[model samples]
Target: MAEQNVPIQRMTIIRTLLLFLAWFNQFLSMNGYSPLPFSDQELEVGVSMLVTFVVSIWTWWKNNDITKKARSRTEYLKGKGIM
Candidate 1:
């Protein structure tokens, strides 16, 4: 389907921002950003990286021209420039 050129909603902006923050938190917590030790740090880092990967894949699947889509505050690396 042809995509619309109209701007998206502001609520979408707010919601996307929240989602990005939540993902970043996971990325931090999983990396043992605080009290977690080095051994557990690996686990956290692995989980965060995996989550990041999944988000990027999902975003690409949702939008064929990923770069052409509107800027969203999502945490996926693929959506970086747009955001």
Candidate 2:
């Protein structure tokens, strides 16, 4: 299938911002600043689940692209502008 020219940098920035917000929220809670109504334990659990889910999905998506299309590690790195 032909891939769309998705902006990887834009996606990365957005994902980073989202993950930062999750961690920042947790940080605030840990320091006794509760932004949400949930208790600390509840908040911790919720954030843990959210971070795990996002990371899992991100890992799967990136790995799928690399494994399905890249001929080698070097090719994958080059494609990602990391080489």
Candidate 3:
């Protein structure tokens, strides 16, 4: 069975959204606007999640190309009875 790879472009989009959300939240805070009445701790958690999401996305993007290449190599090897 072949392992599936995450699409880097989709992850990039998700990362962008996470970053935008974090920035928008901060912007609202600076303007003294509270949309949902979230606590400081909850805001902190939101930032943490954004950071984690971006980091994971970066990691996946970094590895996706390598994973595709490896899969192609594996297919070639199997075709040549080298696996």
Winner by TM-score = 2
How many residue pairs clash in each candidate at the backbone level?
Answer: 1, 0, 0
Per-model C-alpha lDDT, please?
0.76, 0.84, 0.87
How much lDDT does candidate 3 score? Answer: 0.87
Candidate 3 lDDT score at position 23: 94
Higher-lDDT candidate among 2 and 3?
Answer: 3
Among the numbered candidates, top lDDT falls to: 3
Which digits, one per residue and each the tens of the lDDT, describe model 2 over residues 1-83?
99899766888999999999999999997997877888779989999999999999999877664564455776779989997
lDDT of 1: 0.76
- For candidate 1, the C-alpha RMSD (Å) to the true structure equals 14.0
lDDT for model 2 comes to: 0.84
- What is the Å distance of residue 45 in model 3 from its true position? 0.8
Candidate 3 C-alpha lDDT tens digits along 1-83: 89899577988999999999989989987998986677989989998999999999999987664577788987898999997
Worst 10 residues of 3 by lDDT: 61-70
lDDT, residue 7, model 1: 92
TM-score for each candidate, following the candidate numbering: 0.35, 0.42, 0.39
What is the lDDT, from 0 to 100, of the residue 3 in candidate 3? 82
Query: Model 1, 54: alpha-carbon shift in Å?
Result: 30
